[model samples]
Target: MSRITTVFDKLRQQNRKALIPFITAGDPEPALMVPLMHELVKAGADILELGVPFSDPMADGPTIQRSSERALKYGVGLKDVLSMVEEFRKDDTGTPVVLMGYANPVEAMGYETFAARAKASGIDGVLTVDYPPEESEEWVEHLNRQQIDAIFLLSPTTPQARVEQVAKMAQGYVYYVSLKGVTGAANLDLRDVADKLIRLRSRIPIPIGVGFGIRDSMAAKAVAELADAVVVGSRIIEEIENSAKENILTNVYRLVRSLRSAIDEAGSKH
Candidate 1:
């Protein structure tokens, strides 16, 4: 089984919700990227979503946008992010790492090449923000050949027909963008999210993870109540943005630990 499937299966067997945290790989600096990834796992992350910094990240809000900018300033590219993952695997081998980014970089590197390098570097999944499911046949085919999960995004406005299309192609898990707005937007209605998941789950056999505006432990716990996984991104980047270089790892670890604790508390009831 793929690392992602194995992790989700293990979570299901343990009756625990997955705590998946996202970080823009090479953010803060290339030197700290691998360490940050390891720290996230240490802090109780069941899976890691590592962002490949893109120039035009339209789906991302200010926090993630700034993260990409910082990483790009140091000339970090897709290859650099993959290298970081490889370095990360030298010490930790089990945690699943999903690359979250735009499609341009992948297109530049070529899908077949990206798939090969990604699989070689210990990547388990890929979520390209703009790669709609309908047009991803060849893209998905390549990842499938490499055994890498091609995760897709589903928003509140997505239609049933589109959802079905995504379900047919998406592997790993489908990311449900809780808010209609970009990554950091607020006003997340848990009931609304729960309602959507109920319908999507009927069509999608894979696990559903809700992200966007999930900024704290309470929000994480609430999402964990209904979704198979709770994805925290902007909030963690906010943590990274606020902390000093020396304290970034510690601060992020503590925040993720609290989130994991809260999610696990909710999972125990199920």
Candidate 2:
């Protein structure tokens, strides 16, 4: 089984929710990327969503957009992110790492080439924000050949027809964007999310991970009550962006640990 499937299965057995934390691969700097990944794992992240820095990231809000800008300032690209993953694999081999970014870089690298290199670098999944399920058959085929999960995004606005499409093509888990706006927007209604998830669950057989607008432990805990996973991005990037160079890892670890504890509390209730 793919690392992602294995991890989710294991979590299911333990009645625990997966905590997937996101970070731009070369955010603070390329050198800190691998270490930051390790720190996240140490702080109880079940899976890591590593962002590839792109010049144009339309789905991301200002917090994550700033993260991409900082990483791009050092000229970090798709290959550089893959290399960082390779370096990370030297010490840790089991944690699933999902590449979360736009389709432009993957298309530029070619799907076949990108899939092969991603497999070689120990990637477990890919979440290309712009690759709608309708247009990703070949893309899914390439990753399937490499035994890597092709993750997809489903938003509140996603239709039932598209949900069925994603259910057929998607591996790993489906990311449900809880809010209608970009990554950092707020005012998430748990009742709305709960209602949507009930409808999505009937169509999607795979696990659902809720993200976007989940900024604190309270939000994470609430989402964890209804979803198999809770994905936190902008909040973590904001933690990195606001921390001092020397204290970045420490601060992020503390924040993620709190999230972990909160999610676990919800899981225990379940």
Candidate 3:
């Protein structure tokens, strides 16, 4: 099985919800990236979503936007991010890593070229925020050819037809955006999202992972009760930014472990 499938399958077998953590590549420093990844995995992340810094991240909020800016200031590009993945694969190969970002960098590198390089670098999937399903057919084809997943997002406001379009094209798991707005915006109704998932599950074969505006253990547990996976980005990013001075790895480890426990509690109820 592919790394992504394996992780999801394991969670399914155990009747558990996956905990996906997102972190910007080269944040704090490029050198800290690998160690941070390792820390996340050790703390109980089922899957890792690494954000590639982009100049214009339209869907990101102020926190993620700042993270991208900091990463970019350090001269972190797509190639550098992929290089980190290559190095990460040398020792740690079990955790599924999905590259999440905007598409301009990939377009600059060429779709085919980017897919090939991503596969070679041991990346399992890609999620370009701005690339809708209609414009992603070619990119999807290229990624499939390279054995990489083309992950797409489905928002709360997405119509049935558009949901089907994304389901057909999406590989691995589908990212269900909890709200219509950017990453850190407020107002996510878990019960409403659950209803949407019920509708989408009828047509989509893959599991659904919900993200955005999930702030605490209560919220994480609430979503995990309904969705196949609970994704936490802004919350964890906030923890990192707040506690990096005291001890970066230690703080991240504690936070991830706490989130893991929350997910575990919800997963065990099923």
Cα lDDT over the full model 3: 0.89
Q: What's the TM-score of every candidate structure?
A: 0.98, 0.98, 0.97
lDDT for each candidate structure:
0.92, 0.93, 0.89
Candidates 1 and 3: which is better by TM-score? 1
Task: Show the lowest summed lDDT stretch of 10 residues, model 1.
Answer: 261-270
What's the distance in Å from true for residue 7, model 1? 0.6
TM-score of 3: 0.97
Best by lDDT: 2
Q: Model 2 Cα displacement at 90 (Å)?
A: 0.6
How much does each candidate deviate from the true structure in C-alpha RMSD? 1.1, 1.1, 1.3
Candidate 2 CA-lDDT value? 0.93
In model 2, which residue pairs have backbone atoms overlapping below 3 Å?
Answer: none
> What is candidate 1's lDDT per residue for 138-226, written digit by digit as tens?
99999999999999999899999989988988899999999889897888988899889888989999988999999888999999988
lDDT of 2 by residue, 117-205 (tens): 99999999999999988789999999999999999999889888878878888889999999889988987889999999989988888
Across 146-249, the per-residue lDDT of candidate 3 in tens digits comes to: 89988899988899988877878889999999987889777877788878878887878998889999988889988898888889998788877787455988
